[model samples]
Target: MSSDTQQGRFEGKIALVTGAGSGMGAAVARQMAAEGARVVVLADVNGEAAAAVAKELSVGRAVPLDVADGAAVDAAVEDVVREHGRLDVLVHAAGVDDPEAKQLIADALVEGRPPEVTDRLGDSAWRRVMRINLDGTFHVLRAAVRVMRPVRAGAIVVIGSSCVFDTPVGYPHYAASKAGVHALSQAVAKEVIASGIRVNVVAPGPTETGMAARTPDVLRGGFADPRVRPYATPEEIADIALFLASDSAANLVGAVLLANGGRFTA
Candidate 1:
């Protein structure tokens, strides 16, 4: 008889995943664990969901976190470092959505161009989008750097979007936020090499998660070319993230690794 224990490639590293309550974050956390990471801290704005994911992963370190809150972000980093003694992997998956901008994106897809913004594009919409998608990733990266730089060893995988390139029919704000993520990864990869900390972006497209189902229909069918299918699963994208987090991608700093099944390439 063969043993069926799932083994990890990460074997003994400590990882922290934000937005681990669901979607790609949860998937990434599970994959990291399976690949041999000894410890995983699941952090989410929704404490119960985070805890559940931690339990599902069978790890005990689930935490409540609001990535938009700088103090909370800092504390979470400190807690992970203090408890784990060192940090080896960081995954930023926490984020928010903008239905208004999404509508614009979808309209552009269905109508072939964005409808005129006759004053309905609220300032609040822009700020909230930046607050979570952009600012949230910033806070996590900044806090992780403080700890990882000290050890002179770490890898950060930011969850970005295909929209940055394909401009997914809706969610312009999401696309813009992801574009900022790509730029930040490139800048930090340069800034952190001296400290032996690497930063990279993994932009996944049309993953088959709850979030995908909620995506604007125009956005979903936008990749309508018969030759290319855009849909992916969280587990599928997680495998890519696992490689990026592992030693295999040691030289892959500042890379915008795409895992979109040839949607844009085609």
Candidate 2:
């Protein structure tokens, strides 16, 4: 670990990070580039954001992608592998919470209202969250596995949410999607272990991202607790992700490495 960390950890590796336009996804892509990845595919639904990030990286290519689009995901994966020969690492961070649903949940938290208030989530909100979070993850995983399987070597890191553990009442869809992610990652890990492909999840608590800022102050204030201190920066989450993607975590397949700031006891 020291040898690589001191000398470009991912040197020569070809890495792809979904949701690389902003937040945790963008941070992971930048970290990989700095660590020496030969090329970092910065994929995001927002083309402008992705391009901005790619422009800043020494080794990066921006690709507009909506993870929910299976064909797009497959095409992107195919292009990356074709151009680079192999994809050594994949980071899936593209996801979303229905704005209405998210705000309703946060309001419930701020007002100290009963959790049942979130039961009003409409069909569209539920579907939107599910499509982006769960189905999107499936699309990326399917595409990545198709290529990495034959090569018999690759690493995958799925961005999950700590909210899945305790189950918050207001955002059932968000919780459900993340829970599905954890299950999917574990199941895929077991199925692909023989192929030497590793799959893992990194569940972060409240992060210092634009999304977190929009949430209720009551929720973001958790960062003020002495025990939790400061909110986690995107880079902090990326560090854990890079560790799981690196050989240092060789034996840590099918694991959920929670990076929450101790907000929940379980």
Best candidate (score: TM-score): 2
> Can you give the TM-score per candidate against the true fold?
0.90, 0.94
Steric clash pairs (candidate 1): 8-34, 8-35, 8-36, 9-35, 10-35, 11-36, 102-171, 105-169, 105-170
Error of 1 at 36 (Å): 1.7
lDDT of 2 by residue, 3-101 (tens): 234347788999999999999999899889888999999999998999999999989999999999999999999999999999999999999865566
Against the reference, the lDDT scores of all candidates come to: 0.81, 0.88
The reply for model 1, stretches above 4 Å from the true place, is 1-6, 104-114, 117-119, 168-171
Error of 2 at 92 (Å): 0.6
Model 1 lDDT at residue 142: 96
How well does candidate 2 score on lDDT at residue 45? 97
Q: How good is model 1 by TM-score?
A: 0.90
Clashing pairs in 2: none
Q: What residue runs in model 2 are displaced by over 4 Å at the alpha carbon?
A: 1-6, 109-112
